[model samples]
Target: MLVEGIKSRPVYHGIAADPRARRHIFVLEGEGARALLEQEPSLTPAILASTEILYVARGSAGEGHVEALSALGADVAWTAPTVETLLFRLKAMLAVAHMGTRLYISGTEGFIGKAMQVALDQGMDYSTIPTEHRGSLARRVQCVHCKGVTEDVATTPFTCSHCGLSLLVRDHYSRRLGAFQGVCIDAEEPGVRPEPEALFL
Candidate 1:
């Protein structure tokens, strides 16, 4: 998880079943399914019937909980083989989603950001959606120089996936880009790089 007090960090206020919602859309990845599963007690049979669950069983923090997610009996519980497939399905689902639909997302920070990006693109106000952070704390980082995005960054002083420069992952985040900022760490000295730290995993 990112350090507290980072002003740009998205605050996850957790998710709950909106009793009045006619359609409930849950997008989850890896161990994030637990965020929805744990709320079974709060979900009524009718609410569960109207719910649609999309889960990615494999990711940075896979828990092999596809069977468990299916057991929840959401009307359209489907597990995608990959994240790309999941996003494709999610976009389609959101396109025809009704007015009373409520979007909920849970996953690693990277997955959360990506899902939120999709929701935002579909004209959903991010502030109205409920989000829960779960599983790996690995970050999605963007190199300032080449502007290439590197996913699942668990260490500090990592090499930029786009540029060859060594980078220091910063706490500053960009919700629009859905990534954390990574700056060249050895720009001043050119060759001096610190030991990598496993700060987010």
Candidate 2:
């Protein structure tokens, strides 16, 4: 878990198997969690015995995994189609979630960010949450000018879909916004522009 320099990507460690933890909430999206489970078969029984798993997945990729999880006698809940609906469901779940609950999140950066936002809103501490970054590195950006969120923004120096401003996605991440701050690249000079560069490279 040693992060090197300022430019380094966040390094995430594996979730610890804490026997003392009373209630577990496994929030998983996509194939990452499933792959982890497959790699460590023993983890499934332990998870099933104590956790209430909420899975949010799109389409057939998750179908077989969901069935397998169900067969293991897991207390599972599949979220509705969209991320917004899933967030809503998570909010309702967190309304009654107690202190002993532990959160294990596995998904894309944006998906995990959204889930983490909900957890943070519910006052869940970072120590109680362990996330495994999976899927794409694509970021979700929020436009400061219009307060609009641009989802899965793969690159920077792009036009903001909301305010129609050419934005420079900053490295600074906002947990509250669940995105990097996107500022107008040409705001200072008005007509001047900076050449686009690869984001997070």
Candidate 3:
């Protein structure tokens, strides 16, 4: 149980726990992540004041969330992380291992997978802070065209009825599906390839 009186108001338990967090940085992504952060104004500022925060905006199309965060006085450093950037961030996180830093990530499944792999490669203890615990919805990938969001379906076909222009779905299943016997028309790339049904599993 944690309690704090700030400006004569009792602080939430989550806020009280921020000081105990050893991680010097928190990574944020996805739309849900931004919404949650917006809801908890105190926690964001508290976390920033106590430690550093890394904002990964890969796959996010707009700057609204980033702008709002900056307005909140969050000391965030923004970066568009590629596969190579992922490796670099991982290395940086591991270099501070003795400090017992924690990482908070919110993004598409692909981004999450890469981030988790990096954390595991560095031997860092990784945990998913529930939306309730962190006061945010779990991360999700939204279709670039339809805006359909979910974690159940990893692949999003980008032929949108609205725009009719082929939009690229970040972390599209074809990239993860690899080579298979069945046929697949890649959203990011033109052309069809044999993709096995069992290969998806």
Worst ten in a row by lDDT for model 2: 1-10
Off by over 4 Å in 3: 1-17, 32-36, 44-46, 81-83, 127-201
Name the best candidate (by lDDT): 1
Measured on C-alpha atoms, candidate 2 has an lDDT of 0.70
Question: lDDT scores for all predictions?
Answer: 0.88, 0.70, 0.42
Q: Which pairs in model 3 have colliding backbones?
A: 23-101, 23-102, 181-196, 182-194, 182-195, 182-196, 183-195
Of candidates 2 and 1, the better by lDDT: 1
Q: Which residue segments of model 1 deviate by more than 4 Å?
A: 1-4, 60-64
- Tens digit per residue, CA lDDT, model 2, 1-201: 112253523345655445667777777777545634553455556656776667666523735766665555655646456767878888898889777777777777777778989999988875567888766677788888998989877767878999889988776667776676788888878858767666542
lDDT (10s digit) by residue, model 1, range 15-97: 89899999999999887888998998888889999999998886534454787778888898998888889998999899998
How do all models score by TM-score? 0.94, 0.81, 0.49
On TM-score, the stronger of 2 and 3 is: 2
157 in model 3: Cα distance from truth in Å? 12
Candidate number with the higher TM-score (1 or 2): 1
Instruction: Give lDDT tens digits, candidate 3, residues 1-201.
Output: 112332321112221224566554545554424633554545655566554445555556475766655555545455545545655765686666655455555444444445555666666653433211222222233344444433322233333334344333332232222111111235456644233121111
Supply candidate 1's per-residue lDDT for 42.
84
